[model samples]
Target: MNIKKTVEKIPGGMMLAPLFLGAVLHTFWPGTGKYFGSFTNGMITGVVPILAVWLFCMGASIKISATGTVLKKSGTLVATKIATAWVCAFVFAQLLPEGGMVKTGFFAGLSVLAIVAAMD
Candidate 1:
């Protein structure tokens, strides 16, 4: 299959595809990373280095003059995410019982902590 072309066809597909695959892998076979003794284990478990490289690449790709623009855009995105999360938590708090949890129903076992964590 032409992975590059396929990924390019969808917006943000390049990043999303790998993330989806990783989530599936973790969901179905959580031990796969530890089961692999060498490079596979490192590739799965050693995310910090990979994240550092990705962050470095992202930062490196931006022009020096666009630093302010990047900062402003990222700041706005972060603020929006926090605001949205807060609003969601507040709404959930109102929907949930006084203990801030759903005890019985389709949403059983859900709590404010879970909502906040999912939002974050």
Candidate 2:
């Protein structure tokens, strides 16, 4: 099967494919990272730092010659996204317990961090 072609046919599949795979892995084998205990564990737990560098590169790619109007619009959209995510996180925090959600129920492993990441 042509996995690249299959993913290309689905809207946003390039982004969603890895997410689906990760979710499956986390659900079925949450200890897979710890089991491997080295590079695999680092890859699993080091997502934030890697993502920060990727995002920095993305931001740095914006051309300095872009018009003020374009920058303003993009800035407004980004601000709105951040604000909405913050509000959602705040609401989730209020609803969840002090340490966050439960670890072994229907909502197991769901946390404010995940919610914010999904929202933003």
Candidate 3:
């Protein structure tokens, strides 16, 4: 099997297909979690498989990109995006209502994690 051909096809197959299927599933099975013990657990379980697949794909992509320049450029872009997102989240958290349920520090940490994960 040609890996390059398979990778090229992934934009339509792995990417769009999952997005379309997710939309369809969400539309048809909306509120299906209410029947489960806890909505949070049900939601997590439903999404875990997708998340696993995404992580595997990400690992594969990184493995295939052995070029130092490509890695450096990708790292810079990811860092910039993550820094921007973190600043935005921090600013938004600070501006939130006094009684807001979100903790500013927690959100900042989450933003950092998002950036770290993207780099990985």
* Index of the highest-TM-score prediction: 1
Error of 2 at 117 (Å): 1.4
Judging by lDDT, tell me the better candidate of 1 and 3. 1
lDDT of 1 by residue, 53-83 (tens): 6688778889999999988999999999999
- Best candidate, lDDT-wise? 1
What value of lDDT does candidate 1 attain over all alpha carbons? 0.84
Residues 22-120, model 2: lDDT tens digits: 678878998987999877766565677546655777668777777577779989999999999999999999988778775787998888998999998
Q: List the residue pairs that clash in candidate 2.
A: none
Better by TM-score, candidate 2 or 1: 1
TM-score (all chains, Cα) for each model: 0.60, 0.45, 0.37
lDDT of 3 by residue, 32-70 (tens): 556555754354346776677777777677645476876
lDDT of each: 0.84, 0.80, 0.62
Superposed model 3: Cα runs more than 4 Å off: 1-11, 33-56, 64-69, 78-120
